[model samples]
Target: MASSTSLTLSQALLARATSLHQSSTDRVSLATFTGLKSSSTTTTTTPLLSSSRRAANRRCAALPGPARTRPGAVKAVSVETAVGQAADTALVEKSINTIRFLAIDAVEKANSGHPGLPMGCAPMGHVLYDEVMRYNPKNPYWFNRDRFVLSAGHGCMLQYALLHLAGYDSVQEEDLKSFRQWGSRTPGHPENFETPGVEVTTGPLGQGIANAVGLALAEKHLAARYNKPDNEIVDHYTYVILGDGCQMEGISNEACSLAGHWGLGKLIAFYDDNHISIDGDTEIAFTESVDKRFEGLGWHVIWVKNGNTGYDEIRAAIKEAKAVTDKPTLIKVTTTIGFGSPNKANSYSVHGSALGAKEVDATRKNLGWPFEPFHVPEDVKKHWSRHAPKGSALEAEWNAKFAEYEKKYKEEAAELKSIITGELPVGWEKALPTYTPESPADATRNLSQQCLNALAKVLPGFLGGSADLASSNMTLLKMFGDFQKDTPEERNVRFGVREHGMGAICNGIALHSPGGLIPYCATFFVFTDYMRAAIRISALSEAGVIYVMTHDSIGLGEDGPTHQPIEHIASFRAMPNILMLRPADGNETAGAYKVAVLNRKRPSILALSRQKLKQLPGTSIEGVEKGGYIISDNSSGNKPDVILIGTGSELEIAAQAAEELRKEGKAVRVVSFISWELFDEQSDAYKESVLPAAVSARVSIEAGSTFGWEKIIGSKGKAIGIDRFGASAPAGRIYKEYGLTAEAVIAAAKELS
Candidate 1:
């Protein structure tokens, strides 16, 4: 069979259903949930199909063309089909309510989770999981599977309920019962690491939708690079469910603008227009025309007037979204916050808090669901049971197609296989360049560009760009073109001036293939404040994104206090599972890249310099692996009288200070503390060998805040660093004025020793 994208939604559904139904020995239904149109509104429902009519339809479907339709067939078949659709609608309604009730019961059990979004968005969730998306429930990491991100992550119960129905072992019935409890797979918010089916960790509003944009970008890039006319292997859509809160966030607009500019056709977003927030109606703080704004941003916009029971309308919107192959589509689904609750529906009280016991009972009765809590009716369960086997068959069919494609296109298959399986090419690290003391001095930022270009040549997954600071950050890949709407095969991603979106989008790209896509983003070091939330998520979600931060200190000079990063380095050092590397020169810069590439489970931030620095003696890529290593030593047995430590541009100053102290016949040692986090991970023996605890005369020099230096420097030792903001002057002038110099380091060292 060909790729599913080649067929219309209805055709694909019918074909798969007929094929599966015919192959089964027992009664297996892969039937579509159809409904009758309502006279007053788009929301509608029909009764369950009668057994006889369903069997007749199945028999007719399995037969040849002439036997399937007889004389006067068009009118008769239409009438019968309409009747069957009307009957099947009841089953659809039950399935949708199953999702809503599961969410309600879970929230009521926890009494601390959000239930309104799940209750209101059940129809949307049900249609997507049961009908639209293609996936293998047993293999959540299937490369070709559609990615779904819930930007409104507080309503994660909707996803957990759907996952349970769709046969994901990660979200079983017990997991649902344990929602919001510690150690449960179902957390209060969606976390990709904790939950297998979740694509990315989402909690802060707008991040998930931005991540969806990156996911779509990855798909488009891979498809353009690997898909042949006859064999389209890399094909998938990225779907997101965002709410009013996500829209209110500026990060969402930043990412959505790029999504529209890039024309990510396979990105379809469902805007949950419930009009209710935690503080009551959205009218208090939001009243903008979201649909019109999306259209202005170049997105194809559709509005579903009623999302409560508009099952067919939701499906149709997805179909239309898939039809548009240029720009991303946004379906604004208007819904009641709590659709079935008698008193709380559409109210702020239901937005977060659980419906009390009385209200839960009232909701159950209001929806005509007479079953007990957490109960899934046999009929609804039976209808959804087909998805598991169908999903397995879909995956198996794709595997067979891939095996055939591999035979004909061996080279392309090998490359794509590495991306799919996350296997790196052998000896890829040899691509990183090494420098010697004789080499000309250059900014670590400039040196970083060399490492980036070299890595791009060897690592197929290596790709990134700057946040409109490509020149200043030195992050452009010289061999590749920009990854534009038409030129997606190129590696360089132009994220424009969107710093927060750039960081979050890279998180999505890094998390897309799990260790396969190494995405790095760049901006000025101080600008990290703009994207700190996304960066924190990167660390929390274990998205190994390389953050190329230039202008590491007061070194950028004339840009003044606002551009300088006095406390940024110290702040990131406080964050866990993040490598904060301040590479001094060429060798150290290469080493930082090595660490970033090797540590696929932890993000690495390389704080590089704007000013040129000498490629000092004894600085090596091997030494950088140790995180903190002795670059030079004139003393014996690691017992120097005065040990001076530094990182990035300040390392050069410490080395100068060590040379002067040694000339005075003082036992001096210079250490390059490139990465404090990595150094902390070292064995105590290695750390002792580098910074012996007995040496109390330790003095450190850096151009940033001295807040955390006390950990490495003894209480008696002095740290030479600027605690105040930088001034707008020449770098050398600012260095002297701020006491970030060799003289300052030497003076501090003498005072300690």
Candidate 2:
């Protein structure tokens, strides 16, 4: 690690490129570190991978393809030289140029996208894909393949070009041409749902790095659980390329802090230190010593001064990063933003805009490239084509290794297989505890804890924690120990006071294995503001992360307005592709867990209460599944004098209101609108059965914003909610002061009737 090798420096010296002196000690000879295969057995030694793994890599040089070379080939390098000496400076330059132009040309064609990053970071991109990273482009979902995140996602062309060169079918020539277009696999940013090779949806700066931490954490946890000393199965690395913007975002610091604390050694992040943001040089607004900051954050910091062309420096940095086993590494690669463009190379003009036709011509002339747009020099193609076969062979070797491991460790293999392939146990839902009307009253957050512990017992991949609110949120998995640097296999993750990082990290965990790893994160409901971007990404990227938000409303009390989420539920309700669930009792809490577990492609937010409430009659696990169902009804013929609807802590109030109304000889139907999203998905007949369209006298009560309730309550109906901020008082007092009570519901219902 750089910290161990380098001398202690004063604050003044910390601003200097610290890794330059430290990197010299770690650089291996090109012969030993090169990506190319050596004819000389002595030169074939690679310190990065195990010798047994290297032996398994001895396979076909290329997949089956036509023998003849195409036009405009980089004839300077022969097929043998190109494949065998892929690390040769001249050949490597041509490959790097290919990546640069792919970005340049794609951006030129689209008339959009930030091109500076791809242009500057091409060397690192080329080295990673061509030399260092272990991935199967053809099988992007291969279980053991290394994960890569382009955290500076605006520079997605960098990733798109790499995917194209590495031979991902998702980014064929046509897809690159159709970049940023509707329905194109190559979107403006890397959306994992849109592109196969792209790992996570990361346009919002800082999120990808946070996600990378989660990915590394997942690797560490799984490795600890499944990797036997004799037969290691869960082993991989997570690499990320983040820019200055990511560093500027506070979320990155929060996540990186945790990454260092957790000692995610397998995570190596490449900080593209181009020093230029959209506004101009980062010095204009951001001039902090990032290396010093990261060092303080407990990361091994490395700096490659010549990122534009220092291929060996980048390689050496990566090699050194892998050697550091106690903490994550940050390789700061400083380079000119637009490396090759003569007129705009270091200027902000090239940060986002396309270098127009004349400059493109100048760039081409300068780089000595005459090929047409999207053209890959045949030598580069042939050189990169080896990865497909090599990747297949790697997966094959791993599969065989797993087969043997499975023979000896059947039970462990079954559990691991479930983690790899998203298959739940035969009756996983049955493991969720059920509660009857006779059950004691409890806070939904407490009920949620019961569900989480139960789920952890049955579901092998079920694991998560809170944003330093495990005690308040009641999200601790009682049976499991805290997941720390030493105890990686524990189900409980102590995320500290980092709500944004916690949310994004959980997104990464959920997306890591799709349906396999069901990661849940918890915090107070009001704190969603701190992590809305991450939660939104979870919705957009189809990450099934369960957000356990306690202190749902004014019911939390004393903490006052800032701590109470008046609009949180309504806001999440408006967001598409998310289930905003507010359970009233134990049965509904169990149902929320089931819904969260089953909806493997959609994220769920369970807004739980800090205050306890009674387990009301007619509130069932089955009724909660419908999102909204008649919990108590004295009405007949699907026609009631008034319909009372509520959620979370207020459902008991609505039930009480309904009882009072029913006593006055008025037909009342009390509906538990547990999840509006789920209820909207229910059949029209079922919806009508719960809240008949003919009945206009509907009264909806909730301790949230009255914003979107009009959609549920008809024109003649009323919504009783706290439109203003809550007061600092006892929970009961706050509820009474805010009129969030059965009396309010009864008044609204009678007025509507």
Candidate 3:
């Protein structure tokens, strides 16, 4: 059982079949599917062997003998086995057609769905689901299951049909009929939240491929960490079927480049190279050499000329992809948009629009399918009936193997279980290094690094890296090495400088094994503009990614206006389910980390500063958790004359201004607003206590745009912020020029009073 080389889908099946051959000695002929090579010397024995002889033969095969490593290789076949395989191949074709027409019927039923992708790519889908990929349909949460992402998610009916045929209880005929309808699991795009078998929420074109890369990275890392040479407990492949649009999007390049750089051999992608797009022909916009581009990106590329009919070529290409155990592979599958349509085969009408009732009937007639809509032939069902039981049995066998694994390595097994369940260990929060007012002031970005180091020691699920900005962003884990192709067990991931790809990859990692991995990525705060789409997907799909954004404001200084973020806070604050935390000091930074870790269904943006500030006395962890808390109470313990609200670097300005106002016998309450989203979730009593309706004389100050502050500060309040862009100068000069100072805050507070 020692794994010297990475196991592909074919090899894993062979291993399973080999194990079965040992237990069922009477069924020697059944070993043909194990990809075992037969020689002239080996003879097919009869099933009438005596029990004693059979037991000895089985025991010998089960024990270590010569290596049996040729999976999907050329093997000698007898006449009987060949005939049986021919019959099975015919059944496979029928299953493929069943997938095609089911999608067609569903799209026809829902007059607002895409049918072309499923029709053209049905053969590839069938080959992947029935002939190659491994999973337990009864339990889509299998840890070692192969992941399939439909990057061309507009073609989701293609996936839905496959899931239905593969026996997943999640997708039923009624679900298909309710496609794109309210409360149906089948949405317009393949949403991971909506569909059980869907891996990542796709439809934004290239993000799915990027998510696939992250999925493959997760498998490789876990396989390297927990997998023993003898017991490869963490093992699986990540497959994606993408279209021309996915390749056209720039994010695909950013992610695929990293995939190739990491040499993710288990990551196989099928590029459905259909020439037609929504705007007629793809030739008008996208005519680059994709094969050459993939080759340059360090991927193994193969071409299938006739994806409509070349089932054997598809199978061969997969075998070839699985053979290359050092680099990822892409199989360019050439297909017509509408494969069986009489007139609209390669036309733009087939891309998104339904093929109408007449075209559907004509296409069905041309394909010689006489069944009614949503109908599966009896032979097709009989052929596919074994898949459910087979999948369940495979899972049962793996569970038995894992029980042995747990017994031998108890501690590793416990840690792996924690990762699988995504449960933080008791007292794990103690690892978050605490700070006091007496502690030396440091940049929150630097404080974030300390948190990473502390959490790296405690949180078993914690592992991520920055987008090529780890050194400056203070995101490096001290004791861990980089998660490279050679050192996958390392906690730190190097995501190059691709912000968009980094965001999607983190999402994929969070979604991997259903939130088994707690992932975080970093970059300059302003650069969020580049990856906003992926970030939105993270919020929509509920991936709890820690976005450690540094250089949060004008405090970043001479790097200039492009690096400074003025309106960025307002932008992300507008986004739902994302915590926009701007911590003023070390303690507040630790609080942000705590929220990010605990909120398992939402992402958090920890906007850290480039400059250091004094740790204020009232800035407790409890206060920071409230999102907006009273840092300094009014001197008189009654309704304050005015309230000064601020966040990040500007909070200190508000505090200084409040002290000055208090010296003048004016009772001023300074409020530290760290996260608006977290604040909005608080009880009305809590929010009212923090910002009382009676205290209408409020003044807010931050270095960002004044767009969102009106909600916090009422009509009687004065908002002091730069509504314009910043300038290239020293940090102090920029803040002074932009009116982000204690003097300016005091003036604004006086004016409001």
Give the per-residue lDDT digits (tens) of candidate 2, residues 271-357: 987767889777778867787788889898776655766666677677667778888988877667878888888778999899999
lDDT of 3 by residue, 1-753 (tens): 211121222233333322322322222121112212212111232221110100101111111112122232221111232111223666776787789899999989999889889988998898888767777666566567889999998999999999888877668889899999987878899887666677889999999999999899989988888998779888789999999999999999999999999999999999997777899777778878787788889888777655776676676677667767788988887677777877677778988888999998888887778899999889888766666766655555566556667778888877786776666788877888788889998898999999988888988879988888998999998899998889989999999889999999989999884444899999999999999999999988778899999999888889898998989999999998898899988888888898888887789999999898878768877787789998888646448999999998888899999889989888889999999988998999999888989889999988898997889998888888878877899999998887788898888777877
Where in model 2 is the C-alpha error above 4 Å?
A: 1-85
Every candidate's CA RMSD: 10.7, 12.3, 11.4
Model 2 poorest 10 in a row by lDDT: 50-59
Pairs that collide in candidate 1 are 46-90, 47-87
Please list the residue runs of candidate 3 whose C-alpha ends up more than 4 Å from where it truly belongs after superposition: 1-87, 635-638
442: Cα error in model 1, Å: 0.2
For model 1, the superposed segments whose C-alpha errors exceed 4 Å read 1-87
Clashing pairs in 3: none
| lDDT of each residue in 307-383, candidate 1, tens digit only | 77666657666766766789998888767777888888778898889999999988888788999889999999888
lDDT comparison, 1 vs 3, better candidate: 1
Task: Report lDDT (CA) for all predictions.
Answer: 0.82, 0.82, 0.80
